[model samples]
Target chain A: MKKRLFTPGPTPVPEEVMLRMAAPIIHHRNPEFMEILARVHENLRYLFQTTQPVVALSCSGTGGMEAAVSSLFGEGDKVITVNAGKFGERWTELVQLYTGSSTEETLPWGSAITPERLKQLLKEHPDAKGICLTHSETSTGTASDIKTLSAVIREHSEALVLVDGITAIGAHEFHFDDWGIDICITGSQKGLMMPPGLALVAISERAQERINEPARKPSNYYLSLKKALESHAGDDTPFTPAVSLVIGLDEALTMIRSEGIEHVWKRHESLAAACRAGCIALGMKIFSSSPSFAVTPVWLPEGADWTEFNDALKHDNGITVAAGQDAFKGKIFRISHLGYYDELDMLTVIGAIERAMKAIGLPLTPGTGVTAVQKAFLGK
Target chain B: MKKRLFTPGPTPVPEEVMLRMAAPIIHHRNPEFMEILARVHENLRYLFQTTQPVVALSCSGTGGMEAAVSSLFGEGDKVITVNAGKFGERWTELVQLYTGSSTEETLPWGSAITPERLKQLLKEHPDAKGICLTHSETSTGTASDIKTLSAVIREHSEALVLVDGITAIGAHEFHFDDWGIDICITGSQKGLMMPPGLALVAISERAQERINEPARKPSNYYLSLKKALESHAGDDTPFTPAVSLVIGLDEALTMIRSEGIEHVWKRHESLAAACRAGCIALGMKIFSSSPSFAVTPVWLPEGADWTEFNDALKHDNGITVAAGQDAFKGKIFRISHLGYYDELDMLTVIGAIERAMKAIGLPLTPGTGVTAVQKAFLGK
Candidate 1:
């Protein structure tokens, strides 16, 4: 079977990057390896659209989130966390775990937090130390307006703005310095088009000041952002890093740079638009009102079992799409058009979904979805 | 240039494992991925030589060491850490960071700690909560007698025995259950013949009890062993794991199982013996008196610059060997006989080293090292 990955993360890694990583591993401390790290550092800054130092740690995306919470704020420091999806809930959880005093501004899943609400929250919580936001919520396939939200926080509050750009940075246009974001975190498996195990965090000088505050004490030893920045300045890591993954990331980033970030974002946008058009033509409702360009979520048709639909797509068509998480499970299915995806790949996924839906006895016009996807790709 | 990796940790990944990892990425929560994890769990227990559950974390080997310390003990608890090399020093550092009180037993870089010394330390620190040992110190190519040391700790004290078997478990013979080791940690890149991302830690029932103790308050949020174990029960990880690395590891473990553990150890032993014989034939002294089968450290000749030798080997021959770390740097170079390495590979490395030595004006008979390696392989 020809298996295809259409998940939000662990997207299809480019063959060039895979082959680059498959080469013989190099010692991390060697000058050769350090040269690779130096290239990766420069490319990471370019990808993040920031002049600040971006450090890579050998852990998952959640590790980066934890590092932000542990390093920037001390005990009793109140943080305002937005909870709009599974990842947003993680921010709330991390803040509660690390700070013990955080205000969770909750919103229903699949809905974006408005800048006005953020302004109101900031007005209410004047002592808030930071505001955690999700640039693109992977679980719900919705992207919050980071630029607007960060602008609101910058205008209204002294709190540092932290954005989880796990699935957003490469797929969308994210200007860290322009938006005045203090911290931006991403994972290697998502927009970077590589395997997991690396959390790349871009920290601004404002965040560094908080980390270097003499009065602030952090409990974390491994994921210390201060130490990570210190070592990264020397093109090294505090510990033995995931050397092969970094090599893979360097290749992936180089590919992205060659393709141009704007082109990458435009490709994602077009692919996502085609997917949404296909879903609408099939008479299925898009799950998120403000869907992200990284992934497209659609509610299953009436009397459709999401489990059976996704399983048929996997077993019969050799396609793997993600089922909705938490309360949304069994009700929605998501198709990712993030990395290494094109209009042709999107058409293939839509064809598979159409076949699976018909196999599940869902009423759908034959060739409707594929035709719509082709029309969208043709800009009809 | 045809490159070769002969470092200890980032040892050569087998071609099959590399190709497997190079395949399209899969979602971590997908059924296909869970199936891979289930198979990895069974094979990890086999490789660790234990019936206990082995959980995989998406971090380096050092993360596993930190988890063992943070999860099992609280502040002010005393741990006896052995510092014989760079990795052993990490244990002392972690213990002091997590637990305020710890006894560090320092030894010469290449020398192994004796059972009598451990017994005396245990007697002196009667309230010690744990004993940390390095099964194979990669920096010096020294393999400590873990079985004898664990037995001594078991007989003389109630401290939990923790072994950093990063370069030991698959390359050498280690019986976790038989040796009564409480916690054993290994990395993906060393004996596992994979890239550096995943950390495999085998935990015993004793350690689980200590983790579950109500009085235990772990400060770490990401690398929590107790939470990791809970998720592993369902064949999952607490965070997004290194999915491609896990796939690579699955293939590597399958290869190990097919070869049989005993045969694997024998191969490493023979390869290391061949390397040692080759070095001796070239009039070079082995650096570690208690050298590990995973790697062979050789002292550079008097007045010879190790940097120039290694650089020539890398540039001219496309071979990558490790220079000694810290105090041993420039004094010695290491040749790894670990995973994905055989007698032929050892001969090739020895030939390259001889050529580089001759290029550096060192006196050596032509083909002396290669002939010695061939003779050692023939048991002559």
Candidate 2:
């Protein structure tokens, strides 16, 4: 049975993108690959909505996070990460491992961090060198106001605003330049709608200048941004790239560009809205008060075994969704509407949930979820 | 033009393997992906010649190197690394980054670290937790004697032997169990005949025990071997894997197994013999006195401009071989015979080199290189 992906990432890949990935392998140093490499850079710049050069790496989004910490700040330098969810907490971990230990402003689980809090914290800290935040917290399905948060960081003058935009870039509206973001990182598997193994780092000129400054700690050999940039300027990576995945991403980015940026965001917005409405009509509550357009976390109704519900949906209906992480595990589930998704797919997910709930003796009409989703789609 | 790749890595991927990689995307956590992941683990065991579970990561071979350092040794722990070539030097860098420091027994460039030297070092530094060496140093084309080096470490009974087999495993003979190699790390792009995404680590139970001992330093979020093994038991990865590349490696391993492990090593041995004979017949000197069977690094004859030779080969004959790295730059070039290459490919590479050299006024007899390679292949 062919299953549909409604998980936050490693999302459904377009056939065109898949074929592009399956294309013949080429030498990364060859002129042919150089052309593809240059194209990937250009496409990433367009997706980031910035003129800053985007560096492509053959590691996961975590590697991009590591790069941000290892390159921008030296050992023992003070930094702050907005810990709103699992990813935000990971920012603190990466900072501890790569740069110096970090200070974290953590929100309660299933909550979003506010720009006002960040403004107050940074002003108090005064000497912090960088501020890190997750633009879309996939773990909790909460989206932060990165644009406003970055503005606050810019006002602080000493700190650079770095964003982990792994699940936000294509599905949400992020103008890297307009937001005054210094370092924006994303992965190919998430909103980019490609396979895993490529991490993109879009570094502003200001960030680049900071990275070039001498730091106390020794830089990582593979994650050295300066070396990567020097090699990238000649249309080559500092290391062997995931060549096929780069091809996949180039093709996927072209599709996103063709769909138009605003339209892409609107597509995610409508899908998320419909899915959330369907869940509410099924007598469920949304997990986060303020949710992201990428995914909607929903609380399972009382006495509903989320593990059993997830298994039934996967085994019976061939529908794969995301279960909750950390303490929320087995209490909440997530429905993703980002990356190669449509209204029809959203409806299919709703239909599966409806079937699973009715089979488990939960109260539901035959097409109650479907009717609510349709109404939401039509703005009725 | 179709280009032939003889680089140390990002080697020529076989068409069948490419097709496997091009397979329709599957959910990594689904049954389909579980089956594929299981096959990857099983076949990797066969390739590593060990029964211990192997872990695959969606990172470069360098990541595997880092995993070896960060997992077994904590920060401030003493370790030993052999610096014979670029890859060995990389091990030094990783140790410094993850473990905070290590002692390196420097071997002169283009020279192998003799077993006696390793024994001497271990005896001098009994406090060392592990010993690191590259089985095949791609930069210098030097092959270390893993059997003798492991014997030296096993004599100590305390220090584990870590071998960086990134370019050696399938092409060269390695017995992880028989040779007592505690940690053998490799990449899919080398002798595996696949794209660059997956890094394979085969660790002995003894190495796992070392990791189990609590250290003061915390484990890395991405390179956490403990977390990875917990997920591996269920045939799943903790993070999003490079799914298509895993499929390609599975298929490539199947081919290798079907061919028989001994026969694969025999093929590489014969191909390497032919390559060396061809180079010598063309009056080029071998770079490493004890050459690695995976790649042959050869010094250009006097006054031969390496840049012109490589460019003509790539542009005129559509042959892309590897240039030397670091201090060896322009002084030598490498010809890899690791994956997806046979006598015919070797003949083509040697023939192209002869033509390129002749066109650039380097001395070479007509049909000299070809006849030598043919004779070696024919065992005449």
Candidate 3:
């Protein structure tokens, strides 16, 4: 049963990328692997929209987040994180682990962070060392305005602006250089459409120096940015890397390049819009007020059974959609539109939801949802 | 061009195993993955010759080593490491990072520690919390007498006995239960015939209790044994694991299990004996006084051009052997007989070396090495 993955991460791997991963394992120190590493670095920099040297570490997105917190701050340094969703809370947790003091501007699950609030928080904590936020909050299906947030940070403080672009990188319009993101961290599993292993961290010269400062204690050996950059320059890792996954990533990056970054971002935006439009046509309300292009958080009808809807989608229709996390669980379901998705995949998913809703006597419009998505995709 | 990898690790990955790796990735949270992880654990126990839980981590063998050091010992606890080879020296380094206090038993490269000397060291440092050593060190191809060393440690103190069995676990006989090893660590690339990214660690209940103690300073989080075990119980990782490599490892373990453990060890021993006999017939001195079954370290004949020998083996015969590390660079070469290899593979690698030596105008014996290897393997 080859069911397609509509999840935000561990996305459907392209056949070409999967075959590339299956290639014979080469020594990391070998020249052939070195060439691949060099290309991957160049491609990552291009995709991140930064001229900065992006240090590649063999860990996950959370590891990169941990590295940012551990490397940049000391025990008493003040930091602020925008807590819009789960990933935002993760930033606060990591910051607390490294720097004993931190603050959070808590937004409701479906709500986005307003730039006015960000500026106010920065003013409140003028001594803060840095600010952290997620580009796409997968748990809430919302995206914070990085361009607006970074501009606010630039105006108020010289603190580093760290962005967790784990779920948004290839799917959203992010310019690390133009957006003034000091530390941009992402994972391979998300929009990169590769199995998780490599965590990509693009660090500016400022962040690098901040990492080397005497006050900042050594974060970790494996996740050490200093160690990763030293070995990355020579096209090797300080530790044994996930070799096969690196190969898959090289191929995935090539595909992204071939498709063109702007076109890929446009595809994601359009896909998400179509899914939303389909839901609206079915007389369903979106769980997220400010939805991102990565995923669509949908609310079940009043007193409707989420377990039944999810079971019908997965077991009967062979479609797997994620339920909400934390407090949102059982109240809502998420449909992802990120990575290796097309109009037909979205239509099939929407069709399943329509049929399942009608079966449960939820009073959905007949074929209206599927046709709306198809027409939206076709620009009709 | 085809190449035979004679490096101690990443020894040859069999074609079937590579194909197994090419299989599509499965969701780690799914039942399919649970079955795979469960079977992998069972097979790992078989490999380690222990009934204890053998945990699989999504990092290199070094990660497992770090996990053992960080989770078991505290900031001020004293540990003893036998520095007999490069890997043994690594234990000393890791101990410094985790425990902050360590005593070393330094032995020369290509040398093994005597059980009596270890006992003497333990007597001097009876309060030490742990004793760590490499069962087989790949850098110099020296195999330690782990059974005897464990006995000596047991006699002196209640300290845990840890073994770095990275190169020894499958190729060399390691009775984790019988030898009373509290912790044994191995990697997938060597002896297991899989790529890097998976590390195996079998822990005794005593070691588990030490790790579970909350008072132990958290030296590291990603490599923490407690965190890993907590996640493993639910068929998930604390982080996104190296998915494809785990799939490859499952296949490799299946192959190893199909060939009984005792038979696998004997095959390695026999192949190693043949390699040693062939090297002697070629008039080369063995580097290690007590060589390991995993790799044979051979000192080049006096006045032999090291550059010419290494280059010719690679360029002319497409055989890639490992050069000696550190001070032994250009002084010795290592031929590995571990992982997805047999008599034919050994013949090919040794034959290449013989031809390369003759090409360099250093040896007089033609077909002498091959004949000896064949005779030993035939045992007639």
State the C-alpha lDDT per candidate: 0.90, 0.85, 0.84
Instruction: Estimate, for each residue in A240-316, the C-alpha lDDT of model 3 and write its tens digit.
Output: 77777888889999999999999999999999999999988887789887788999888875657988887777777
Chain A superposition TM-score, candidate 3: 0.97
Off by over 4 Å in 1: A214-218
* Tens-place lDDT digits, model 1, residues A21-96: 8886778878889999999999999999999999999999999999999999876989999998999998988888
C-alpha RMSD in Å of predicted model 3 compared with the true structure: 2.0
Ranking by DockQ: 1, 3, 2
Residue A375 error for model 2, in Å?
Answer: 3.9
Cα miss at B210, model 2 (Å)?
A: 2.6
Task: List model 2 lDDT by residue over A1-380, tens digit each.
Answer: 87778888778888898777776677777777788889888888899999988999888898778877777776777889889789999899888775657898889877877777887898789999888889889999988888877887898757888999999988888999888999889988888888788889989888888877765354565666777777767767877788788878889989988998889989998898899999999889999978899999999967799877887788888889998999999999999988898888878999999988877777778898998988987766
lDDT of 1 by residue, B1-380 (tens): 88888888788888899889888778888878999999999999999999999999988898888888888887788999999999999898888878876799999988999988888898899999999999989999999999999999999889999999999988889999999999999999889998888889999999999998987765777899998999999999999899989999999999999999999999998899899999999888998879999999889866689878987799999888888899988999898888888778988999998899888888878999999999998867
Q: What are the candidates' C-alpha RMSDs?
A: 2.0, 2.7, 2.0
Sort the predicted structures by TM-score, highest score first: 3, 1, 2
lDDT of 3 at B320: 81
Cα deviation of B37 in candidate 2 (Å)?
2.1
Q: lDDT: which candidate is best?
A: 1
Q: Higher-TM-score candidate among 1 and 2?
A: 1
DockQ of predictions, in order shown: 0.68, 0.53, 0.54
